[model samples]
Target: MIRGQCLITNKDDQYNDPDVAVILGSDKNPTCESQSVLMAPKIKLSSGYDMPILGFGTYNLNGYQCLTAIHSAVESGYRHFDTAFNHENERQIGEALRTQIQMGNVSRENIFLTTKLWNIHHDPRDVRRICEHQLNLLGFEYIDLYLMQFPVGYRHMCDEILTPINDISVLTTDVDYVDTWRAMEELVKLGLVRSIGLSNFNMEQIQRIIQCSSSKPVVNQIEIWPGFMQKDLVDYCRYNGIVVTAFAPLGQPNREKHTPIYFFSEGMKRLVKKYKRSAAQIVLRYLVDYGVIPIPKAGNPLHIKENLKIFDFKLEEIDIRALRGIKSKERLVQYENIKNHKFYPFERED
Candidate 1:
């Protein structure tokens, strides 16, 4: 039995009870065996659905590589997958998932699929049309979770042009995000999507939607890592019953030549040695303990399996404090092209 006192029956059932906890077994081994596959703990969303606490991100993954990665991820016991319309690999992801289901590896009801509505389709009138198109591409009956990609809206030059640019900057539109959210609420009523959410949105923007719309967002996907822990935003979302989904939880790769020194701090080194885990596993486990669902992307099959092995261990309070104490703060996924948009969510550096 797992350590936590709470018991959860019917692993696939969505419950409103706050007392249920889905704790994993106490096996610390990371081997990839049939009996050793770990089921990730599920967090209850305000939408009355259960989401796995960790997911596999599909950004920049396409063609044969995307299919192979999805196969490896399913074999590794990953039930949740994160993808975006802008990522342009929905068809391949859909096919990979179909093949898995046909092979008796997994079922649709056991999987959680999350996709985003791009900035260009933020107009309320265009929201459903684009969502339908995405569904057609993915060959799904309904999306598990649909997210507004960003607070900022862009000019819709055409369906083909994802990012319409006016010389040096992205063309901006004044469509209110609240209206777009209202359209998403309609998707829930029409059985097109199970839950709706926000991505790259600040607290103020989220509050505005809450004030204006009858439906509330259940999740907020954003960039979070050890060095750039947005404590305030994370806390605020948790307080409001909105689960935070972390993208780039292990931080962006190859963009920066050298890893930040904080990643190799004495505290982290000690934890790595003590846990017999890699630095990436430590960082991912730390984020899960901090109360956010991390979606880390990896191309290598070994690395993909390694990412799922984090649920076996729990971080100590002192170790969590040591990670929180790191002084470096950097935002890696800044959409600099949309910085000047009226609805841009991040702070503008002058």
Candidate 2:
């Protein structure tokens, strides 16, 4: 039997609960092989909502591919779905989610749905409109969590004018993130969302938001992987009562030139043999051990199942220490296009 302690955050920002523990075993584990991975525990957010420590990410996936992957993910026992308006796959995810709910696979209440407010709509007047547009696309009553996709605000109103790449035509907006955050806070008040959070924001930016907004950001979704540990920022978020969710946990294997699978070196081979798990699983377990939620995007059903199987085992603290020793601070998802924007995050370190 493997014993693991669940981390619960109280109002004071403490992440400990010695009184609560879970054992991974046959009787306690569900019979279905896929459902067995649902044993992954939930972490309570400051918003009083519990989110699964592991979430299925929907990025760079579109149309039928995204729909199929989401449907497969739910069948594989994933309860959390992470998407963004910028991802352009929300409609597909929404359709898949609705279909699953109708088919009795999972309910909206049980799934943690997250979407972001694109930077184009950062203007206070545009926030609600973009959010409502996403709502209509999602076909949902209320979003579980809404986040600002990036700190840099853009002035483009039409989708055709906005492009992911840097274009002189796409101008930066004068609207501040503080104003956007406050508008996001209104989302909670209007019952349009359960919680509001941040994504792609750095430490100083997060501090400014906290100081200026009425509602504290419940989470910060950033690029985190075995190679890019981001210890300082992760520490700051944890200490400040914000849950950190790691995207690109497997090092974006497809984008090897930009985000190489550095965790698959000779040093990791021993752990792979010891745990009998994939390199991706080991990397994910490392984040979970540090109380950081990891949202790994996997299109293959086997990979999805393997990713969720991390809960069945716990790494020794010594091993975790060694894993942390592998240091490379390369950020994979840095928006180089908007790096020069005044509100651009990652311009400074913690």
Q: What is the C-alpha lDDT of each candidate?
A: 0.84, 0.79
In model 2, the runs with Cα more than 4 Å from the true position are: 1-37, 164-170, 254-261, 348-350
Quote model 1's TM-score.
0.90
Candidates in order, TM-scores: namely: 0.90, 0.87
| Alpha carbon lDDT at 251, candidate 1 | 72
The global Cα lDDT (0 to 1) of model 2 is: 0.79
Best by lDDT: 1
Q: What is the C-alpha RMSD of each candidate to the true structure, in Å?
A: 5.3, 5.5
lDDT of 2 by residue, 1-350 (tens): 11122222332212245322232322222443323223456778999898878899998989888998998887777778999987998889999999987876566787789999988888898888889999999999999989898888887658544553354545677789999999999989999999999998889999998887677899999888876878899999999999999888877875355336456567677889998988889889888887789999988888887888886577888889888877786677777666667887875434
Q: C-alpha displacement of 330 in model 2, angstroms? A: 1.8
